[model samples]
Target: MNITIERAALLRSLGHVQSVVERRNTIPILSNVLLRAGDGELSLAATDMDLEIVETVPATVGRPGGTTAPAHTLFDIVRKLPDGSQVELDIGGDGTILTLRSGRSQFKLSCLPVEDFPQLSSGELKHNFSVAAADLRGLIDRTRFAISTEETRYYLNGIYLHAAKSKMGSLETPVLRAVATDGHRLARVEMPLPDGADAIPGVIIPRKTVTEIRKLVDEAADRIELSLSDNKIRFGFDSVVVTSKLIDGTFPDYERVIPVGNDKVMEVDAKLFAAAVDRVATISTEKSRAVKLSLVRGALTLSATSPESGSATEELEVNYAESPLEIGFNSRYLLDITQQIEGEGAQFTLADAASPTIIRDVADSTALYVLMPMRV
Candidate 1:
């Protein structure tokens, strides 16, 4: 196949598709991207067996054919060439050596049989729905930080997405829910269920899929299409398609971990509170990393101490009329929840020094984070 494509357009798709390809592959053909030229466009497909990403870019086809070539090598060759340069790719359709030409640069890259490339098949997808691109993005960004990295609890290593009973109000019974946790902290967010997606299967989008979904979300688009079956999930938007295998293990019962009777509530500016915690954390012990929060009538004080380093202390004006309380939490967990707060004020609820603290944006009840308290 012979085709000419704009460097910028080709590079954009290659950058994403190649990221899904691993640097080392036990199967030699898996290291290459399957290129197929057809009706006015060329498609590039790459997969790491578990995650598959495919992109189609518009091209001027001289001869319609296909081949496979090293994705990273082709990416580098085009990346170093001048911007806006026209890249001409030609393949014999027999899946042998492929050729690349740009300006004065020329390359004959070794190719493998395109038939050897793995294809992600969408077989009888039970549910199909459309999600606002921004909403899809929010669902991942708000909870992904809490996803467990621990390999032993493999089920919790991804975000658990399902329909959940609404937490705040009486009228709204259930909403689409996304939850993530790593034992110490948990983040949960909700959005009104989309029309066609009501029967969507409860699925765990693995860590890898969560990452690739983030890239598609960054594009300035209004909506995205999602397809899901028992084991696989696929997302389609514009010229890109991303498909992945869902974790087969079951996620933990997250609702039990959510505290309901935390009576102490304190409101503080998110930006200021995060800044104070960051400063005090500098003096926290490397292993424990605890920061103590002491709340009095009208003010809150943050302090941390380490046997090897100096201590740090700071204060912030807060809105809390409850009795004084002292609590310690992992500084990193506290910062993560606060960073997601969009508005000026963040609401914190606590029952005791050892109880888990609940945090939420003062104006938005759709998102909430619960952090387990730690000893000082």
Candidate 2:
């Protein structure tokens, strides 16, 4: 196999594909990336059994063939090469060694047979659709923070993506939604259903896949192609493709956890509220990370107390008209949800100190958050 490619182009594609290869692999082939030189282009692919990323970049192919080499080693070499330099990759008759040359620097890397690499067959992806890059980013950013890290309840480890009927006034409107929860806080965000997605299966995208896809979305085109089945999902950008296995467990019925009877309403500037929480949380216990919100007719007080770290309190005028109430929550969780609010104000609906609280953005109706209260 032989190929001559621009250093920058090779580096970019390598960066995308190498991240899928795990740092430590039980199988030797899994540590290598497959590089194939074809008609005027080079394709790079890497996988860690469950997640695979393939990217194609234009190159000057001297000979059409393929080889597999250490993903991280090749990426580092290309990254260190001079800017605008041309990279030449050549494999001899034996095919056990790959020679890389850029300018005056040269290195030889051990190669593995391309035939040994495993492929994750996408199978027949019956459901296919395209979503705008902005919409896709919104769906991931607004809900990914709530994805659980616990391994025991593996189902909640990724975003639950599906089509649902959202109530619009007196009508039911079809929408695509992403929901994530960790038994402490829940985030549910939705957008108008994309074409050909109404029948898409309810799939749990693993957290690792979400992280990898989100990183590439910024570099992707204006629209991204999505294909899925019951157990697999794929996202295709212009020059990149990511295919991943769906989590096998069942996600709990999250709708039952969203409180419907919370009537005590309060509206506060999200920025101000977040700042108050941050300042007060400085005195909170490290184990609990708790901050108490004391709400009254027209004001809210954010306070935190720790027997060893001391105590702190901050007051802010709010739009609450309901009865007085006090609720405790994890300060980190509170800041995470408030940071997602794009608008100036965040509205909170409360039933009491013990029941769950519902929070929403005043200007955006498509996103909702539910937080379970803690004992102060």
Candidate 3:
């Protein structure tokens, strides 16, 4: 196979496909990316079995054929090449080596059989929908931070995406909910259910897939196409196609964990509260990372203490108190939920010091977080 392509277009697609290939692979073919040139276009594909990404770009195809080459090596070489250079990729006479040439520089890299690369089969997706790239991006940004990295409970490791009844706030009807949790903290964002998306299956999108799709959607033009089946989800936009295997476990019913009838509501300046938590958490025990919230009559006090590092306390005027409450939570979790706020204040509802707390932004009612309390 031989092809000539612009560095920008090649790099853009390579950047998307290469990430799906891991730095280490037990199988030889898994380490290489399949390059297929045909009909005035170049297609790049990479996979680690669980996830696969394919990106296609326009190119001048001198010959129509396919080959497999190291994704990272090719990426590194092209990245270091002269600025704005067009690259020539041609098959060696033996068909076992790939020659890369550009501006007086030439390199021969080992190649593998394209047939050895495993292709993820496309299923007859039951649901097909499109969402604005910006909206999709917001949903990911607001919830991805809470995905669990633990391997034991594997089920909690990815974002739990499904259709849920919008319990409270403006969009009171049923909406699509994106939720993630690591036991200690949780992030949940809701959006108006898309047309024809009401029957989409609920699935846990793996962490890597979430990250890869997020980057794709961010760079994609206009809207992103989403297709879902029983065990797979696909995203395609701007020449890129991503397919991920959905985790095959039921997500715990999240609503039971979200407390209701929490009469004590407090509204405080989000920035001020977050900064205070940051300051106090510095001295808190690293293992615990606990910050205590003391709300009494219209004022809220944020504090954290460590036996070795002393204590910190900062006060902020709040819109609180049907009852006085003291609750302890992970400072990092508090900051994460609060930082997503776009406006001045964060509204938190409490049942007591031990029960879960519901946090919402005053300016936006579409997103909420449920944080478990800690013992201080």
Candidate 4:
């Protein structure tokens, strides 16, 4: 295949596809990206068996054919090339080498037959919907931080996405919720359900897929098209399509973990709370990093102590009118949940020191967090 593509366009497309190619691969073909030139466009595809990304960029095609080249190597070459240079790619006479020419630089890259590349099956998707890019991005950012990294309990290694009835104001409304937990802290965010999404199946979107889709939606204002099957999900937008396999495990019922009827309530500035936690945590031991919260009439005290290091205590004014309560929590976990609060103050409902605590954003009823307390 022979094609002439502007360096800027080619570089952008390569940036999207090459990320799927792993640095080390057991299969040689998995390290290569398939490139096809036809119909005034160049198509780039890369896959690592579990995830596949395809993108198309406008180009001037001299020959209509396809080949596979090292994804990372080609990306590096294009990235280092002079801006605005027209890159020309042509298959050698032997059909085993791809010659790349731009400006005065020329390079011959080893090629593999496009037929040898594995293509992810696009099964009949049972659900398809379009959601605003901002909403989709918010769902990912608010919950992904809580995804578990442990491999043993693979079910908790992803974000649980489903449609549920939620109180959006005073009336019950359909909403899409993303929930993630690591047995220590949980994050849940909801957005208005999209059209044609009523029949969508609840699935666990792998952490990697969430990360990739987040990058795609950054700074994008257009709606993203989403398609889902029993085992796979696809996100399409801006001439790019990302398909990923769903985690084949059942996510634990999260509702039971959320605390209910917790009468002790406290409201504190989100930023102030996080900063106090951070400051007091400095004296905490590396292993525990535990911070203790002491609440009384109208003040909250954050303190941390380590036998070897030192101790710290910080007081902050809050709106709490409950009996005295002392709770110990991992400082990192507290900071993580507090950072997710977009409102001025974070509201916390507590039953006791041992029971889980419920946290919410004062301005957004659609998001909530549950954090399990620790022993100080």
Candidate 5:
């Protein structure tokens, strides 16, 4: 196979495919990317068994054939090449080596049979829908931070996506919601449901798939096409398609964890709240990193203490008319929720010091967060 592709175009496609290739692999073919040249384009594909990414880039094809080459090595070579250089790839008659030439540099890379590369099965997807890039991106960015990293509770290691009836400006509306939690904090964000999405089955998108799709959506100009089955999901946009296996576990009942009748309410500047938590957390012990919030009639005090280090205290004016309440929380968890608030202030509803607290953006009703308080 022989093909000539611009360095910039090749690098862009490589950047998308190579990331799915693990640096260390038990199977030799898994370490290589399948390259197929035909019809004035080059298709590059890489897979890690659970996830597969395929990208097509326009090129001048001299010979139509397919081969596999080291994904990372090829990416590095193209990345270091001079800008606007035309990259030429040729597979030998024996199909054992690939010769890459650009400018004055030439390199021979070991090749593998493309037939050995594993392919992701395109199952019969029961649900198909389209979502704007920005809407999908927003849903992911708002909830992914709360995805659990623990391997034992694999069910909590992804975002729960489903269609539900939610309140949209006092009217019941069908909305697509994303929820993620790590037992410490939870994030829930909802977007208007697209047409034909009502039949979409609920699926837990793994953390890795969420991250990869985010990257693809960032570079995509057209609406993202989504197809989901019981065990897998696929995303297609532009010249790229990503398919991933879903986590085979059930997510917890998140609604029960959310506080319903919390009466005590307080509103504080989101940025100021995040900054105060950051400042007070400096004196907290590394193990705990706990910060205490003391709320009075119209003011809130943030304080942290460590037996070995020191202590810190900061005061912020807030709009609180409820009874006095003292709560302890992990500083990092508080910051994570506050950073997602894009409104003038963050509203917190509390039942007591031990009960979970509800947080919301003052201007956004579609997003809500719940954080479990920590012992200080």
Candidate 6:
């Protein structure tokens, strides 16, 4: 195979595809990327068995052929080349050596047979739909922080996506929702259901897949194409395509954890509240990172104490007309949820100090967060 591609274009495509390849692979072919050049374009593909990313970029093809080469090595080589340099890739007649030439630099990389590389077949994705990139980004960014990192509860290690009916006044509207929880905190975000997603089944997208797709969304066009089945999900963004296997476990009934009886309500400026919490948390114990929120009818006090760090306290005036309440929460968790709130104010609904508390953005009704209380 022989092809010439711009360094920037090749570098960009390589950056996208090489991330899927693991640093260590039990199978030799899995460490390489399958490169096929033909029809004035070059295709780069990499897979880690469970997740796969394939991208096509325009190239000047000299002879149509294909081979497999080390993904990371090639990426590093191209990244170091001078900007705007033309990269020429040539595979030898014996098919064992692949040569790369850019400017005055030349390198030879070992190649594997294309037939040896495995393919993650996205077989007959029955459910298909399209979503705005902004919507998709919002769904992932807001919920992914809550995805569990524990391997034992594998089901909670991904975002559960499904079609549900949301109550708007007295009417029900179909919406696509994404939910993630780690038993400590939960995030639920939704948007109006797309036209073709009405019958789509609930699927848990693994944390890794969520991360990879989120990166692609930044460079993606206005819309992204989604195709999925019971066990697989595929995303298409212009010339790039990503396919991943769905998690094979069932997510918990998240609705059951969301507090419905939290009557005590308080509204506080999110930025101000976050800053106060940050300052008070400086004296919190490193292990617990606990901060106490002491709320009265019109004011809230944030305090933290530790044997090593002594104690700290800060006060913020809030719009709270409910009865007095004291609650303890992990300071890191508070910062995480508050960062997601785009609005100036955040509403906190509390049932008691021991029970879960619900928080929502005053400016955006589509996102909700439930944080489990921690003992101070």
Residues 1-376, candidate 4: write the lDDT tens digits. 8999999999988998898889999899999999999999999999999899999999999999999999999999999999889999999686789999999999999999988998884676879999999889889989999999999999998999999999746989999889999999999899888888888889999988888888879835588989998799999888999999999999999999998779999999999899889999999999999999999999999999999988999999999998999999999888888988888989999999899999999988889999999998
Runs of candidate 1 with Cα error greater than 4 angstroms are none
lDDT of each: 0.89, 0.95, 0.88, 0.92, 0.94, 0.95
Give the poorly placed runs of model 2, Cα more than 4 Å off.
none
- Tens digit of lDDT per residue, candidate 5, span 4-24? 999999999999999989899
Count residue pairs with overlapping backbones in model 1: 1
Q: For candidate 2, list the clashing residue pairs, or say none.
A: none
Name the better of 3 and 5 by lDDT.
5
122-185: candidate 2 lDDT, tens digit per residue: 5778999999999999999999999999999999999999999999789999999999999999
Q: After superposition, how far is residue 355 of candidate 5 from its true place, in Å?
A: 0.5
Task: Say which prediction, candidate 1 or candidate 3, comes out ahead on lDDT.
Answer: 1
- TM-score for each of the candidates: 0.97, 0.99, 0.97, 0.97, 0.98, 0.99
Tens digits of per-residue lDDT for model 1, 1-376: 8999999999988898998888998998878888999999999999988899988999999988888899999988889989989999987655587889999989999998877878875465778888899888888999999999989999998998886668445565668889999999999999888777778778998998899889777883688988888689889888888999999998888889999999999999999999999999999998998999999998999999998998899999999999999999999999999999999999999999888889999988889899999988
Task: List model 6 lDDT by residue over 319-361, tens digit each.
Answer: 9998889999999999999999999999999999999999999
Off by over 4 Å in 3: 167-172
Candidate 6 runs further than 4 Å off: none
Question: How far in Å is the alpha carbon of 235 misplaced in model 6?
Answer: 0.5
Model 4 regions lying over 4 Å from their true place: 168-170, 219-221
